[model samples]
Target: MTRAGRPTRTVLAVDGGNSKTDVALVREDGVVLAAARGGAFLPQTAGVGAAVDVIAETVRQALAPAAGAPPYADHISAYLAGADLPIEEERLRDELIARGYGGSVVVGNDTFALLRAGARDPWGVAVVCGAGINAVGVSPGGEVARFPALGRLSGDWGGGYHLGEEALWHAARAADGRGPATALADAVLACFGTATVEEAVIGLHLGGLQIARLHALVPPLLAAASAGDPVARSLVERQAEEVALLGVVAMRRVGLLGEPCEVVLGGGVLTARDPLLMSLIERRFAECAPHARLVVADVPPIVGAVLLGLDRLGAPPEAYERVRAHFSGAAGRAAGDASGEEVLTAPAG
Candidate 1:
């Protein structure tokens, strides 16, 4: 909706992750008309049908505020977690286009969004540590470096999921006196409310306990590390090393290791601002890439989606500024307002 009889130009942007997905309808001038957030849309985890259904409904609601206006946007940008490979991105893009989601659809790994959102230029590295770990780098000349990120099978490591599993392994080993004694065994037992680590492990194997819930153990493991637990501290240090290594490798591949480079850290574990973890990561980077500018992303991933969309649309500079102001002023929560709905929706404006 625009002045008297004019229809405004808009872009449909999406940032889909493992746990949540955010969609936005942004006008050419950067006015966010509507926004919506929903559950995961990962085809690998949710199946293709359910993933499409969830993504479609989420986008529909995001465009609901402006009813009869051409629903067609000048461009659409979708950054999704499971769209790791180029073929995967192309398939998803075709699906979105088949549904008439936009005039043109562009899809890429969600980590690229994290990278663009935190760094001003395309030349930098981004390491995301959340449900999983991923890294991407872009050089000044437009070359890129990225990982498959298909879990341990792909030789990838370090994330909440992996850290929690490591915690379980070390705790179980300590409980059986096969490894050095540490506070993790007691902490792990306390986290699961079990009498002992053995009970917890047995319950997990017998399906009495949820293995998916291991991600919740990350905080406790880090807390144990902060409390001087040797095993826990070692786990945390290893994660930091892994993160730094990912960034360094990406930088080296792009021939930016010797030059000053921006290394962006994002996702759940990194965004938590854990002192020991952050400091250890800094130490690791200091030893390898001394000129690295490490930045912990403060903006939401959707912001990156919108920024990319704006670039595609060739929107003016002020357009991007308006969008940034809206996000930053709202403290980066797109759904900061309550619209009196039973289910929460991220505010589009």
Candidate 2:
């Protein structure tokens, strides 16, 4: 309800990534009202029906604070990691409608939200490389294109997981005398402290070692290449090239590269302070997409989801900034300890 006693329209924004799900609520004027976070609900990782349950539950919790108020139905915009498939999008849309969100729902892949966050302009490209890699671009006329990212067997590649795995693979080959000796073998072996590469592999499956543990290997791999390890050097170079290629495809598909457009970079790997990898990516972009500038996303993807929710309500850019500033200040108050509601309230512009 408004201070003048009139009803207000509310919307929910959600970002479901490979590792986490974050949801937020906002007013038409753009103040964030509430927010929450949970686990990922990608059907590819969680099973179709199970993923639906996770998403439904996450939504229920996110909406609980304001549910049952006037305007029983609310607007909702969700960006999910594995909803690129139409069937998946349809399933989620149907579910949202059934849950009474009605004529207020938008479902899309996670990459699109990152793109929207980096550039509100209609035509732009977004490339994300963390545990995985993918790219997407949209044209001013709403045309969209994406690259196939089917992982190793399909040569669908780029990102930290693949890079770390490649380092280990070559290290094992070198240890077995089938390949030239490189510093990666010694570096990775020290990472695991196992006498052999085979033992390190076995220890990974024994389960107490968190998968995040492997994230530690990425920097050393880059360091090895910086120090002139040929295999590691080639691996980083190839991965950087592939990521750049993905960005180029997005820009060209949307007819934005030769013109004015922003190519946004997001995700953990890109956020990492690796000078070599960063420089290589910038160099490739200079060659393949001279007109597209790489902009770092200003807010996390969930905030992008919130902006998306407001966008559906026709909120102006100033409206977004007002609320964004509020949230930014609020988040700063408590820093890392901010709760979901606290984070939402931070954007009280």
Q: What lDDT, from 0 to 1, does candidate 1 have?
A: 0.82
Encode model 2's per-residue lDDT on 1-349: one tens digit a residue: 5534656667777788877888777777777777777777767766766775666566667678555532233687888887766777788777766666535788887888888766656468888887788889888898898755667654677688888888888888898899889888887778888788777777777864555566667889989988988988998899789878988988887787788677777888876646787778888877777776677665677766777777787775676775556555655633332221210001111
Q: What is the TM-score of each candidate against the true structure?
A: 0.90, 0.84
Worst 10 residues of 1 by lDDT: 338-347
Residue-by-residue lDDT tens digits, candidate 1, 223-283: 9999999899999999998999999999999999999888888899999979899888888
lDDT of model 1 at position 345 = 17
- Candidate 2 clashing pairs, residues 3+ apart or interchain: 326-346, 326-347, 327-346, 327-347
Q: lDDT, candidate 2, residue 94?
A: 73
* Steric overlap count per candidate: 4, 4
